[model samples]
Target chain A: MAPRSIFLLSSSRVHGYEFLEHAKEHLKEFLSKRKVKTVLFIPYAQSDYNKYTELVENTLKPWGYKVEGIHAKSNPIQAVLQAEALFVGGGNTFVLLKALYDANLIPIIRERVLQKGIPYIGSSAGTNVATLSIHTTNDMPVTFPPSFEALRLVPFNINPHYLDPDATTCHKGETRDERINEFIEYHKKQVLGLREGTALLVEGDIATLIGDRNAKLFLPNKEQAEFAPNSDMSFLLNKT
Target chain B: MAPRSIFLLSSSRVHGYEFLEHAKEHLKEFLSKRKVKTVLFIPYAQSDYNKYTELVENTLKPWGYKVEGIHAKSNPIQAVLQAEALFVGGGNTFVLLKALYDANLIPIIRERVLQKGIPYIGSSAGTNVATLSIHTTNDMPVTFPPSFEALRLVPFNINPHYLDPDATTCHKGETRDERINEFIEYHKKQVLGLREGTALLVEGDIATLIGDRNAKLFLPNKEQAEFAPNSDMSFLLNKT
Candidate 1:
C-alpha cells in the first residue's frame, strides 16, 4: 500500500478569503508533487449537486487543474479508481456519508485513497468524514447514515471549524469545547479541534498541523495540549 | 386518546431563571386539572440521573407533586404505566433517545401518553423527541438511537433552542434559519423555531404558541410566518 496523502481542511473558506482562496497555495503545493491532474469531486454533501460541482470546478480550474463531478459519472467506484485526486466538498456530514453509502462506493474509495495513496482533499463536513467516525461533526443530523463509522482513513476523529467559546454569547446550548468534552465521555477516540485557517497534512504515517493558529488536542484523562501551527502532530498517528 | 395532553417547552431553563423555574407556572397550570399527583421524571437525557432527578424533584415538590426517577425503578415500563405525569428533562437529545430504546420503554411510554392521555412535559432534548422525528433538533448526535423516528406525538418536527440569526455575530457556518431551510429541502415537515422562554402547548388538535416572544415558523414553500407568543398555532396540529 502506498503512503497516505490527505489534506483535511477545517473549512473551505476563511475570513478575508474567497471561497477557497486562502488555501490556494497550500492545495497547490500538496498536489504539485502528485502525477494526476484530473480530480474527481464528490458533491454529495449538498442538495444541489450541479451548483456545488460548478463552484468547486471554477475554484480549481484556474490552477491548471481539471475537476469532474462524481455524481455526473456512470460508474462512481471505477471513477474513483481511475481518478488522480479526490475532493469532497462541505455541506452536511450526514448527507455526505449517506450519499457515499447509497452509492456503495465506501470500499473502493477507501481502497483508492488508502491502498493506492491517491491524494484526498476534504473541508468542513468533507474534512469530518476522514476520521474514524462522524461523531464529532458540528452539523445537524438532518439525515441518518447506516452507521456512524467513516472511512477510518485517519487514526482519530476531526472536529472541523472548531471555534473557541465566546463568553459573551448568550446561547445556552453546549459550546464547542463542552460538546467535545461530552463526546469524549461517551467515545474513547482522541479528537483534534482544528480551528479555522488550519489543516492537517497527512503523508506516510506523519500528520502535521498547518496554518496560522494553534490546534487543541483532547485525549481521555489528560489536559488539552495546545499544539502551535506548523507543529509536528504525527504523534497522533500512534494508534493508542 | 384523552385530548392529547402535552407541553413541549423550548428549554428547561431561561436566562435569569433558576433551573426549570421559568416553566414552573406553566407546568402547574398544565397538569392542574388532572388528578395525578405523582410525576415520573426521566433523567436519561443527562448522565447524572441522581442529581438530575433531585433537582427536578426540588422544583415541583413545593406544589405537592411527587417526582420519581425512572432510572431507579426495577421495571421502567410499569413505572411509566403507573405514573401520573411524565417529565423529560433537557440535556442531549441523542442520549435521551438511545436510553429510551435501550430501556425498551418507547412503546409503553407512547401508550401512556398518547393512548391513556397522561400529562407529558418535555424541555429541550425532551421536547425534540415529542415530535414526529428528531431531524430538526439542534443538539449534537453524541449517540445513535434505534431510529430518528420518535413518538409522532406532534405532526411536525420541533427545533428547540431555536435562536434567530445574530446580525452582530460573524460565525460563518449555517445559521439556525439556514439549517432549518436545509432540513426542509429534504424533509417535508413544518418546523417551528421555538425561542427560549417559548413552548408549544399541544392539547388535542390545537397547538398554541405560548410565551412572551414571537416564534418563527417555517413551511415548505411559503415565507416564514412570525407568530406572536399568545397566537393560536393549533393549525400546526392539523396533519399537513
Candidate 2:
C-alpha cells in the first residue's frame, strides 16, 4: 500500500494574517513536493457551497493550482477518484461529516488518500473528520449525522482551534482541558488539541507538528503534555 | 394536574459566590411554594454520582430539603415517580442524556414534570436536557446517545452559560451566536442564550427571566434579541 500524505490544520485564518496566509508557505511546499496540479475541494461544511468553493478556488489559483469543488461535479465520488489532490476546508464538523455520508464518499476518499497516497489538506472541521471521530469537535451539533464516526484516517482524535482556559475569567463554563478530560474519561483514545496556527503533517508512519504555536496532547490516564513547533509527534501515529 | 414549576439555571456557581449560593434564595422560594420536602437529585452527569449527590445534599440541607441520588436507588424510575421534586445538576450533557436513556427515565420524568407538575430544577447540563434537544449545548460529545432528541419539556432550546464574542481576541473558533445561528438554520427552533447567573422560571404558561443579567434570544431569521431580569419569556414556550 502507498503511504498517506495528510496536512491537518487547526484553522484556516490565524492571528494577524489574511485567509490561510500563515500556512501558505507550508501548504505550497507540501503540494509542490508531490507535483500536484489539480485539487478537488470539498465545500460541504458551509451552508453556501458555491461561495465556499469560490473562496478556495481564488486562494489556490494564486498558488498556481487549479481548484474544483466536489459540489459542482456530477459525481462527487468520481471527482475524488479522479483528483490529483483533495482539499477539505473548515466550517461546521457535523455538517461536513453528514454531507460526506450523504454523498457516500467517505470510503472512496479514504481509498484515494490512504491506498493511492493522494495528498490531502484539511482545516478545522476538515481536520476534525480526518481523525477517528468528531467527538472532540468544538462546533455545535447543528445537524445530526448517522454516526459520530469519521474517516478514521488517524488513530487519535483532533480538537482543532483548542483554546486555553483564562484563569482570570469568571466564566463557569467547562474549560477546554476539563472538556478534554471528560472525553478521555469516556473514550480510551488519545486526543491532540491543536491550537490555532498549527498543523500536523503525516507522511506514512511519521507525524510532525508545524507552525509557530504549541499543541496539547491528552492521553487517557495521563497528564496532558505540550509539544512545541516542529516537534516530532509520530508516536501519535502508533496504533492505540 | 398540578401546574408545572421549573427553574432552569445557567450555572450552579456564579461570580464571587459559593456553590449555588447566589441561587439559594430563589431556589428556596420556588420549592417553598410547592411545599416540596424532598428532591430526587439526578447526578448521572458527573462520573462520581455519590460525591455529586453529597454536594447537592449539603447545599440544599440548609434550604430544608432532603436530597437523594437516583443512582443509589435500585429503581431510578420508581424514585423519580415517588419524588416530591427533581434536581438535575450540571456536568456533561451527553453523559447525562445517555444515562437517562440507558435507565429508561426520560418518559417517566417527562410525564411527571409535564403532566403531574412536579417542581423541576436544572442547571447547565441539566438545563440542556430539559429542552427539545441537546444540539445547542457547548459541551463536547464524549459519548453518543441513542438520539439527540431530549425531554421536549420546553419548545425552545437552552444554551447555558452563553458568552459574547471577545472583541479583541484573534481566536477563530465559531462565536456562540454563530453556533446558535447554525443550529436554528437547520432545526427551525428558537434558542435562548442564558448568560451566566441568569435563569428561566416557568410556572404553568408563564415564564420569566430571573437574575441580574440579561439573556439573549436567537430566532432563525430575526435579529438577535435580549431580555432583562424579570422580563417575560413566555413566547419561547409557544410551539415552533
Top candidate by lDDT: 2
Query: B1-240, model 2: which lDDT tens digit per residue?
Result: 878888999999898898999888899999999999999999999999999999999999987889999999999999999999999999999999999999999999999999999999999999999999999999998888989989888888999999998888889898888899889878777899999899999999999999999999987784689889999999888886
- Cα deviation at B82, candidate 2, in Å, is 0.7
Please, what are the lDDT tens digits per residue for candidate 1 over residues A1-240?
899899999998888789988788889988888866888999999999999999999999998899999989999988888899999989999999988988888888888889989999999988888888898988888998998888878889888988889898767777887788778878766889998889999998889998889999988753588999889999888888
Q: Worst ten-residue run, lDDT, model 1 chain A? A: A217-226
State every prediction's TM-score relative to the real structure.
0.98, 0.99
- In terms of DockQ, the best-performing candidate is 2
State which docking tier applies to candidate 1: medium
The alpha-carbon deviation from the true structure for residue B50 of candidate 1, after best TM-score superposition, in angstroms, is: 0.8
lDDT against the true structure, each candidate:
0.87, 0.92
How far out, in Å, is residue A178 in model 1? 1.8
lDDT digits (tens) for residues B20-74 of candidate 1: 7777787888888787688999999888999999999998899779999998999
Residue-level lDDT tens digits of model 2 in A25-70: 9999999999999999999998899999889888889999999989
